[model samples]
Target: MPHVQPAAPAPAPPVAAVVVLAAGQGTRMRSSRPKVLHALGGRSMLGHVLAAAAPLGAGATVVVVGSGRDQVEQHLAQIAPTAVPVLQEEQLGSGHAAAVALAAVPDIEGAVLIVNGDSPLLTTRTLDALVAAHDAAGSVFTVLTAEVDDPTGLGRIVRDERGAPQAIIEERDATAEQRAIREVNAGVYVAAAGTLRRVLAGLATDNAQGEQYLTDALAPLVAAGAPTAAVVAEDPDDVLGCNDRRELAARRRTLNDRVLDELMRSGVTVVDPATTWVDVTVSVGPDAVLRPGTQLEGVTSIGAAAEVGPDTTLVDTEVGEGASVVRSHCLGAVIGPESTVGPFSYLRPGTRLAGDAKVGAFVEAKNVEVGEGSKVPHLSYVGDATIGRGANIGAATVFVNYDGVTKHRTTIGDHVRVGSDTMLVAPVTVGDGAYTAAGSVITSDVPPGAMAVARAPQRNVAGWVRRRRSGTPAAEAAAAAESRTAAPREDRSEPSRADSDS
Candidate 1:
């Protein structure tokens, strides 16, 4: 008997290769795009499956791509970051797909783990366990199977008296006795080198469907007295393959729910799971709270103790610890610790907020940075600019960072105070501790500690309102009234919803 070590702290040994059976016309999907190429959240369908197959630390990863071979190859190359693709030209059964995949995986001294690309929920941990279980038992071939409470449309596991070894009988080919069995083949397998190699070679297209049944190969392995056992996965749903839109939707929801659940489990608080959809790679630090209607996607990461959502959408954004991003749409941005963003703000790509920054309601920031303790609190567009620490930007402030042709930068130094409705034209600088008065359109730079006020002389129109009310000429009233209302309009409150019914 082989020597057995006490509970090992390390993970399982590496496998020979992972054979991904992805090739299928996927007729039920009914799309010009391959079913495997369909987008789930921000990633393609193949991406989810490839992610599952990765981290197994297998020697090689062979993907069987038939219908969308070229596209699959290209997508795998792009998104997988790493992982090799193999071609499966013909539309054949699972057995045939495995045969082609084996050709791609060179010299297999260890075990070959077969996984269906549609089974995206199967994690790398499961694959590792399946391989470990196979090798530990000294089985010639081992398949990842699951017991279904209601085993309809699934293959039944037929075991001997000792429940030691078994063969799988697909629902289509099984007899009445086999149909009553509860254990089903879950379409994931870990097979030994010599046994799997011979089985693939001997696979005949002698089934009722005129296709080589991979399940039938199990019978030959059993006949040869090579130990064959079913390593059942804890959850049967993980092995579910998507054939139609309904199945695909269910799978996508399941994966998303799992991602959300993991976040909650890791000390993050999610108010609602049904409406909140987060992508697979997203991370939420401990004590982070995501309220309802939050759709966080891409590689978004929310830091510790952060509060987000209640109708917020973020993509590819990194929010630092103690940050609060609420009711906003932020993308490709980074918010530092203790920053607060939006009741209705839009932080677009290249936006960065240093610690303790406040980007308040109705603000739009792009390619901009609000330094630590800086505040761009209301009704502002700060784009292509860098506002330094402890700066105060008053309401309706605008960084005129773009000309008609090229975009420019506006640099505001520390302790600067930009007054309401101030427009700082770019390639300009507001020096340290400078104060720009309200209503200034500053085209030139302001020196340190200086008070810059740029405006035309205020003309007194004392009788302006009297002229407008007491039947003055329409033209003059229009001009005078406009000037009178300008200041009030600049301080306008939030507009009421036009289509809102009382």
Candidate 2:
């Protein structure tokens, strides 16, 4: 038997610098905000692009900014601190933007990956493949291309008879034959740093748009006999760009579907993918269920066997194992194991629930800590309060933590029972095993094992309704009831004697 030698491992992709073009005015979007600042799946488009490029371990990353420079630059600092932002004073074109980005990293050599910041759906896998293809072919210039059914408004890839990419012709400059081409330039490229610098320097504005076209550099590079190629993307949607609100919505839907699909494949159950939206930054553990209308955003994480949804939005919140949150809005909150929240609960920042705790329907809690086995059940507002273990806060309860000036704290000890319609005024405490009577407004602290009832004694004003409310339905009913009570009973002795005579 012939010994089969294993194929030599493919050469490692070269370490390349990344240049992100974000200088477009995007007037078609009809918004004051910059195009790349628009969000998809809870992240700005520029943030998504940067995240995709981060896995490449690029030697340097440069972002070209034009309109809305301040906002874009500020956003860059937050999302990608190490990335350098260079200003493009004018909105010349993509070619001009690329040139400005390259100028920022003058010493960068080897391969450089140039991408559009508006393509949020572009993934790391596709980018890695593009780099590998460029490295394998040893091309000085490689353009990422995609085949689409409609090539309208997109630059067409002009390939020679040998099926090699000769040039990329923009829609305005292309001829009839070129316009018919379905293979379109995806606005992504991998080029040798030296070649890019040379081509961009000599870019011309003779075309229809009268702007320095990046696509024009391709023909010259091919003419100069520099090895150039085109790598077709496996998924065309990976190269889709958002130009208007409709396109942005479409891209968001596609990206959200992809995120949910990955979750379902990894043992997370998505009850309705069409209505459930999960951010790229969110994490859901195995066996967790996400029901319809769930929006998990901004670093939210759900633990194993947790159930979320049926109209829930959690942002920057954490849910522990076996917890359930339904029809609630929670932000920057923490729910411990086996706890439950919702059906109209609003948990604000600094809220924490311990094991077996419950914040039931119509309960709003903020800056409050509910201990293990404690519950703030329906129609309650608990803020700046600490509840001990096994405490039950009854319906219509309010921890009046705010005075006319400053906010104060309310403390409830273990096994305490707060009755319905109770208002425990701030700066008060209910000790262990203490109870507050219904309809009480507790203003002072209650000792251990004691009951606090602070309400006026009951007193009746008889027949006041009939005197004060004459001619009303209630007054008339009161008068009728009094007449019946005052009426005398009839005797039956005479009636028995008359019946015997008859």
Candidate 3:
């Protein structure tokens, strides 16, 4: 009989309930929208916090909202439906906000993990590490701390004579000696739920700001002989919070750097990481080259060996393998393998370019599908149309897809040649191998192998100018003056005239 090994010990169950404090009216943001609702790296700031919290497998997650409760709650409902929202009627201190969120959580035997919603850079790994440390030490309270070069405006960690962390001192309430301390509170804590409720209930509004300071609970926990511990994060930036516009921009740059670094390390070549902004939700495949000034936003994906611009923005778009997109704006579009698009093109929603196709400079396409091996060169708008394989669309062709009342589509079959300055009105089709003469307005279908020309026959009157001057010397002189005024310009660079011109 084969010997069987015992199964490994089962993993411990989740022991914490999350409370995200987001109640303060972010006055520094100077917007009617709540600060936590501001977008960072494609999603809202609170969204990032919730994303980090998801991996914890916590018992419950509650968000405390104040001034813009309606807007924040509505947005949260879409992104994080499971996170319960509770209103904090007044703008109090961070401790007070956490208390409001905690009240929404069920009274259970576990730890309470309090986090700030504005700190988007906080990672789930760090929170997991904090929980692990708390469990190993068997402490009633664990405070996340970091040592920064500048601890201004942040709460400083107060230590006892033995150099063990004893309490946290807010910047405004700290003395000159206390201000010199480099270790600072990250405003994150995991405390025993029963003890936390008692601490919060006893908090008093007695500080200089006359607000209940969450850090105040640390001293009481230590005095009551309950074991307390502090875990310092390796990276100080990870705990930084966004309080104003300058800080918000700094946070965005930090997040962008993290995203670009991951992309480059994972086989994507980012030419200039400083100028390439990839949102959290964007994905790029291996060997893809992203040039400077490129922004890949919401749900955008680039395939292997693809090159995306020195100034391109793609949102909710997909670019296939070996394709090249240069200086273009594409939103909700798809480009097939080996396709070439734009030095200045705009591809709107529902636009699709098949394999080996080309959409050149100054072209705008919306709700259009260009078949494999087809080409739409320059200075054109092709909307609500389908162009078949091997079609050659000239420089100034337009698909008149809309009437005053409704929009319609035009279809051109394989091997069709659409001449320069051609207009294919809606509800029209050109059959395979059909051609449209230059400057024609095609209003009806053309059969296979046929050419459609919708213009009047040209009529030339020989010596018409001379006839107007045939009478006398005075008449010739007047006609000569008029002829000079009507003479063609010497500049050949002007745009070509339409066939309808006299």
Candidate 4:
């Protein structure tokens, strides 16, 4: 016993690598864009697929793109920089695409998980469960499958007498009996690293479509004495793949419903979940209320106790606690606690409002930092500006920040009053306690506690109104000259009492 040493626990297996096939031309989509680039729920289909794969922490994740590689790669740089991209120059087949992806990671020792980039609804839990089942069965190859009522476009799963998956047959290639099979291959699989590379290398393009089929690999893997199995997904809809615009729209609805459900369950009050759309990347804290027709997209976050929209859209915005955003469109802005924005307003990128700020109807603010207790009341454009605390921006006030040559900034200090219809020309400042007169065009700065009026002085013409009303200026002047001449020659007489009364 002393001489026999205990064997160390087997070292944990390496994380699986992922290969996503995204090179299909998607002619049925009837658009110039790549199929995987089509958006659903404010994100492209590839984005959603990558999001699902992110939790796996795969050793390597490869995306195989063809038709629009440049656009896809550009997006990937921002969304999934860690994942590698490989190009499949021709529209061959899924088998060829996988081969291309596998060539990039030739030395991966662990399993390879192959997934379709168009299947955005796949959950990480299902993927994890599939991997667990594969490991538990000790199979060299495992196919993810689902039992759908109508397996029309999907490849049907062929099973042996023991209900073991033997192969997958496409609808076009399936016989009548195979067509009756209810279990369909979901186009997702996990294969031992070496087995996949070897099988894909030997795959032939002898099918009716004259293209290599990834499903063809299953038959060989099964016949070679290698263990093979299939995992049936609990929900068939989870494996839905988009090919055209109709499918894309259906998928978008499904994703939106799922997002809304999750948000509602997390202590957020959704007044109308049917009309509300929250993207997968957005977060709303507890006690927040999302009213009808509200759309939160692109990594937006709403703090606790916030009220958003009867109809509003917020993109990549940060909303603080207890804020009310109603019928507004805000992008890349930060709204502070207890702030109220819009019956109608547009808050552009770099706009930040401190607590107790109000941006009223028809107000547009861009690249401005508004201090606490400041209000851009209504019908105003406050751009490239900084507004200090307790400042009031009157109706129709505009910060004329951009000249023909360049853009400039306007500063409004604490307790400043910007009168209605005022234009603060840029590179101008209204100091603390300063007042700008109504309808003023302020080109220069106003010092502290000063009033600035930029308008023409008033002028009066004594008889101008009567002369215009008479419409005979020359005749009236002649009559006055005659009366003056007669008055010097003889006594001027007053009108008789009867004529005056008449």
Candidate-wise lDDT, in order: 0.85, 0.93, 0.90, 0.91
Instruction: Write down the TM-score of every candidate.
Output: 0.86, 0.93, 0.89, 0.88
Model 1: lDDT equals: 0.85
- lDDT of model 2 at residue 5? 100
Q: Residue 169 in model 1: shift from native, Å?
A: 2.4
Q: Is candidate 1 or candidate 3 better by lDDT?
A: 3
Residues 308-374, candidate 1, lDDT per residue (tens digit)? Answer: 9899999999999999999999999999999999999999999999999999999999999889999
Best candidate, lDDT: 2
Clashing pairs in 1: none
Full-model lDDT, candidate 2? 0.93
Error of 3 at 381 (Å): 0.6
Candidates sorted on lDDT, descending? 2, 4, 3, 1
User: lDDT tens string, model 3, 24-110?
Assistant: 888999888889888889888899989988899887888888879899899988998988899999877877887777777756558
**Which is better, 3 or 4, measured by lDDT?**
4
Candidate 4 residue-wise lDDT, 10-61, digit = tens: 6644346989998888889999898899988778999888888778778899
Per-residue CA lDDT of model 2 for 281-368, tens digit only, reads 9999999999999999999999999999899999999999999999999999999999999899999999999999999999999999
lDDT, residue 103, model 2: 88
